[model samples]
Target: MKTIKILLSFALTATLFTSCYTEVVVDDFAYVDEPTISLNQLLRSHELWYVDINSTLGYGETPFLQKAFTVSFINGVVYANNNIAGLGANGDGFGIDVGEYNAYENILDVYHDIDGFSTFDVYEIDYNTIELYNPNNDTSYFLDGYQRNNFDYDFVFYDNIHYFLQEYEAWEKTYTSEYGAINEFDNENYLQFLAGGNDSTFRSSQDDTGINANNLYWDYTGVYGVGDVYGDAYLKTLTLDYDYLGNEYFELSVINDGKIELFHPSSETVYEFEGRGYIQYLKSESGTKKEKVQSDKLRKQRKDKVANPRENTRKV
Candidate 1:
């Protein structure tokens, strides 16, 4: 009888071990229809960009249309930014956001920190492609196939101009005219280029009270967004846009960094105000610390090296 009992106990123990092993197997192979992605692991190394809106709910002026999107995951948290022109309904679509995510039961729950936003679900993630349904979206996917940006810099020339202006309240112009008329400039008594949003702001000096000539502040106004172009000019020279009369104009070959060399030649607009002079936005040393400098210098060096080629081959 004792021997029989021992055999039964051994059989029961073996069965229990088999059951535990079966549970682990089921855990890994639990979801069959969709791939089981370890969400935390995948998000750490990869990011997503919007390929296009999903074509399920029919398309006509959807929010994600023609808009850029980038989603990043860091330390179990998510951050996103949209470059939509008029961001979301009532300006809700623009700006940066921090959010959280949880993957459970074959679903991804995204919780945005912005108000008037609802928790969204990600139903499927296929390789680099993703399927999501935003409450704002008429169909699944606020965007699809969000890929990584290995060189993730959303910076444009306009952004650079904005930051440079925001850093300094007043600026000085030291320029050389084509005829050597406006070459001599003083740092203390500088031109009044009051930096305002969306246009060429009124001109003012350090002692200028209002946007006028009480302290030699001219009426150099800019009707912004109408003539602002941010791109490279011919021969890789970065340019800025200025307006004259009812026509649009681009100040080509204007060297604009922290210190600007305003050498664009046009007798009508502000380009010829000093006839090819340099303008420097004066700021506290701490303020202009991070501004990118000497890019034009590097550009010149490359041009010179090409123009006057040199070879370093010694006594061979």
Candidate 2:
């Protein structure tokens, strides 16, 4: 009787283990129907996948996808546009290689250089839209695929203008419209939009700092926000809340890569600021042989130009 009981217990344990293993294998590759195109071909079919950050639905973060505005999969490598300065021109529109990825059955396994391994279940929602669901984090990021020529780089830049403001150490006042009533903003000569720490912090200085970003002194620190103007792709609204000066509002527009124009509705004044101490993030060494060589040369040029910090700064 005891021998029979032992045998039964062992059988039950084995059955449970087999059941769990089978469930895992099935879950990993849930779509049983044979795909018309392999996952590799599907990912590489488009030149870029624009991560719609606002549409993300989950609590957890997925490494590179969370930070990148767009992700590209090509030749088993992963590239991302982590900055807005050179979105359309960087790496011939491929941006920087952040890691390598492998796609099999409907699963994409990425090994990011800094964030390490992550697994995502890919689902095609439509012809241009696809959902990248990270099972580990219970997060889903919807990406709209586009070719290099079709992608609207301007829209992406205006949509994410907040990050662009933080890209420079300081914005020096270069132009202010002759018209409009004089207000407190006229006294503000420089503005600094910072990242981290709540992500909306801004500082203003009345001193003339020129292209020397580090020399600027903060006279007032405040919180600022950028809001979109409905129906207009290029127009945005900015508001700066100061502790002593109350709230200031303006119509913001990107004049160029390093210049921003803010139209103050209250005073009817237009202010243009030039970015100082421009920051460019991440340039990896992985890509095609030619791309790698080009990146190397660019790195050498940057090294030589590092002696003059103002080389990247521009006057409006």
Number of the predicted model whose TM-score against the real structure is largest: 2
Candidate 1 lDDT over 115-193, as tens digits, reads 2233334544555655454444333433443333332233323333433332333444444344523321211233333
Candidate 2 per-residue lDDT, tens place, 114-211, comes to 66899887888888888887776667778999999999998888878888887788899999899999998999989988865567789999997464
lDDT of each: 0.36, 0.79
Over 4 Å off, model 1: 1-32, 38-42, 48-69, 81-97, 123-126, 136-149, 152-244, 251-316
Q: Each candidate's root-mean-square deviation in Å?
A: 18.0, 13.9
